[model samples]
Target: MIRLPIKFLGLLLFFLLNVGSVSAQYKQTVLNKTQLLLNKENTIPLGRLDALKIAVVTPDAQKYGVFVQQLGRYADISSFGFSKYDEQTKYFNTIIVAGTEGDLSQEMLYMLRQSLINRKNIILCRFQEVGKNIPQWAPLLGGRITELAYPDFSDLAQQNMAMSIFGGLAITEGKAINRTEQIRLQYTRGEGSGLNIAKMTQKIDFIANEAVREKAAPGMVIMAVKNGQVIFEKAYGSHTYEQTVSTKITDIFDLASVSKIMGTTPVIMQLQEKGIIDLDSTMGHYLWQAKESNKANITLRSVLLHEAGFTPYIPFYRYLKPGDVQSKASTSHQTKMADNAYLVNHYYRDVMWPEMLKSAVKPIGNYVYSDISMYVMKEVAEHETATPMDEYVQQILYRPIGMKTAGYNPRTHFDKDRIIPTEHDTSFRKVLLEGYVHDQGAAMAGGVAGHAGLFSTANDLAIYGQLLLNRGEYGGMRYFKSETVDMFTSKQSKTSRRGLGFDRADPDPKKEYPSRLSNSTVFGHTGYTGTCIWIDPKHQLTFIFLSNRVHPQVSVKLYDLNVRSRVLDAIYETINEVK
Candidate 1:
């Protein structure tokens, strides 16, 4: 075993003795009472737990290293060394971080707040002598944290004593799982601040207007928020062709690609947080089966970000058996392609696996948005979580957030007659697609593949939309975390307009998106079936629009863009601005 350098240990002891007393709040508990040893200045107090050896990171090391050294003892902290000091990855749960007053880096303080997203246990301590101008760590922390600006070391000790008592109380009586009482105590008793909801709303309105003008549909919903509360919420257009069927505050809509934003992405995040999987793990690692050498190194991150370089769309529903085909079939041979039941069934079973045997193109070259990426993700998620995708989402998100209306093939949860139909696929099954998956590939896979299967209304989508706003926390429960949301939503290097499957700002105006949005903070997605959800976190707003654009003909891209634009403009106009 490697030993810690003795000189470093000596320096640490010197600092402990010279740095004056740590707080008496950390009592000198007796370990047989024989270990009591007061420092020369009678300033330091020691305890058995304190005696527990800790690896000291020198001041010369990176700042996060220092912060980790100081804070790690109070909680579990782990780190992966990066090539550069600034790029270090430190794992933190919600452990409050306190530091020498005014002495901490603002960025480091922000990191402390962000650590709370996946990890719920966090604490912040303050140094007696640091000054003001502390970094705004609230957003990362998910709320304003209690600041302990003690007048002296003695006061610091007393304050910690009081905090410890409160912390103990919080642990023992944690006002039921759904109760906000404990949080109220944390706010009132602890010096805490909340997220700026007003600002969140404003940003959303701006983005919604952009998406509305860019990708017009019949109806829309826009919302924005931070820390699990509504920043802004509004709806545009009718829910159905019948004008009387207005969209309710809670009406559910098919999320479409937004479903990935809700389903696969979040599930992957949770798996990472639970230590069950690594983001960088090769697809082969989780699936335990390699598709091909070219695809071997493709990670979950690559697939989620659409960097796996697969084809964009595949016409899977084109398969049919003889007379089962619609006369719309361009050729008798094309009709024959659909009628062979063996070919169609075999295609479903084999599409996702044996990646190496298919096309010779490597997975590393460029970004391509393939529905199959989600399909592969579905397999990885199920294998890792040991549960079906629907059940996994239900257990981890839907049930907790009260998204009772969200699911794949939502025939049981939604009213069949009221649900909007997407297409009349004469090519495959020759049936109207409603109350089931619109994507033929996902339908062939039991309507539960990673892509294009989930059915939710705008209202149900809003719950998830709001959950994203909160950075994975919603209602009274912690879902994922703010940091994970940031990672997934922030633009990746390969695409400016795409963060995983979510939308983002781009310089190219002609690129896909509602044309009105011209900023980076806005993120959203549109469905091939004329459904969309856009959110502006900067403004705390979200706009969801759902339409049966395929009613007469499956105009995959046909819609009156003006109607969506008008609604988007109206929502923006109604935005409430609060200083």
Candidate 2:
């Protein structure tokens, strides 16, 4: 066994104790700020609002939307303009009134009074005067705002106050603000240790050689994060066999099936917490088509678990042929063929939805790994929330967690060179898939589908995995309750080792993937385009592997080489050796 130096252990303990004290002090400061704003007469403590629903009320929502939206990153928040307030607005536990230049209308004042009478918490920004007499609501706000000479109205002051409201969370300046101190605490508490880099390097080199010999992938990028710290991140070989361009750590890859978990699953979890979605609720509750079809009885839980009786996938794109003309018409899906050549096509969703609704339902209770299930669930989620799936997930989850490189339809926002090419397709569009989704169904759906369309860098994926390891909390933001995370990640069915939207560690020792070193509590998912994210809460470990294994052409040779499984095994072996 590899023994850690005694001095290192002592230092680790000392650092953890100091960090704990510091964290407590920070919490106290935030509490004090809350008390100061809510006044001494307010009996309801600020802690009550921790898990409560919050909304930002503003007279001019568009003007102050960005500020409130920034706060939404650290808290679950909904926004409404002064004119939009209604009976539904009363449901919010905490209503924050962002200052506006105009005076508050009588209707607005009535709503504020009603909220106070309902015992709802209120936070007021002193940027503007709300009414002639400040004494009426001044007691609720602790004090009245008085005009002073030469006030320091700087970005730093705004950020500091926002941080206080969010319980001392540092907002994203230019880069991600990682909770490295918490990671250190988890590490020192025996959750994980620094990786055995030399051993892992040797193993990766051997694996790369094997992959080359077997003609698997020309290159690979692997990153392993343990207890929030990136222990190992490296790139290998060239972009492709034909192209000699060296791969970099920032290169994005087609995530394929990984999109199910990364792009769609977290959104479902968030919606569930907001009481907008229920796992046990039927699909018909959200989708109109499903309500009239035999799928009316299918529950959202079964859909997420892949037991919803949907087929694996349908070649929906096959119905639409590429047009010979290259025009920038808004009606057609324009795809880049070459430097100037393009393929313009349109998806016949009118026919597709009817056909899907009339399709016969298969018997439930068995796990049949289906992509169509996620596609249907995506539509249901979108319809229920009245927000596009891509936009909703990005706003609530990805942006908040600081996943800079994760999103769908990458070509619109990211440069082509940063996005690694996937395959040279001869059968479908007859174009090299660069900055385009490789999945035909998602591509036909305008490159925004639940099953397979997301592209992200290893760094962003690592941040997401770390968020899961932290039990759905990151950067002082609670995205989901710990119980909610556990509910989704825990095994749901006996026949299949499937969590709600995650693939659980196989109980059987003979199962492939999710290395034998992982405990039963571990859950993760893999993508068709050589990407995988495995998180082990038992060990506080997160492993991410990204590669263009299908570059130049799609092949199963990479899986035959078992490169990912071997690398994962090596990682665990190193961890065990250290322990």
| Number of the top lDDT candidate | 2
lDDT of 2 by residue, 1-579 (tens): 988899999977754532211111111111111112233233221232334677777677665655575555344578887776766577887776655334455566667666767777666544432244543344533333111111122333333334435433322221122111221111111213445667777887788668855668877788886655456778877678865688787789899999988888888888888898888999888887778898898998888988878877677656654463343443553654333334455442564556666666788877989887888778877887889899988888776555667898888898988888888877666778887888877776667888888999887787677677767666556777865777677777767989888887787788755786777767889998888998877666788888888988988987887888888888888889867
- RMSD (CA, angstroms), candidate 1: 19.7
Model 1: lDDT equals: 0.50
lDDT of 1 by residue, 194-299 (tens): 3343444455455444443443344445543222223345665454444455544445555567667667777877887778888788876777565445666778
**lDDT of model number 2:** 0.67
State each candidate's clash count.
Answer: 61, 0
* Candidate RMSDs in order: 19.7, 13.3
Q: What lDDT is reached at residue 80 by model 2?
A: 84
Indicate the TM-score of model 2: 0.67
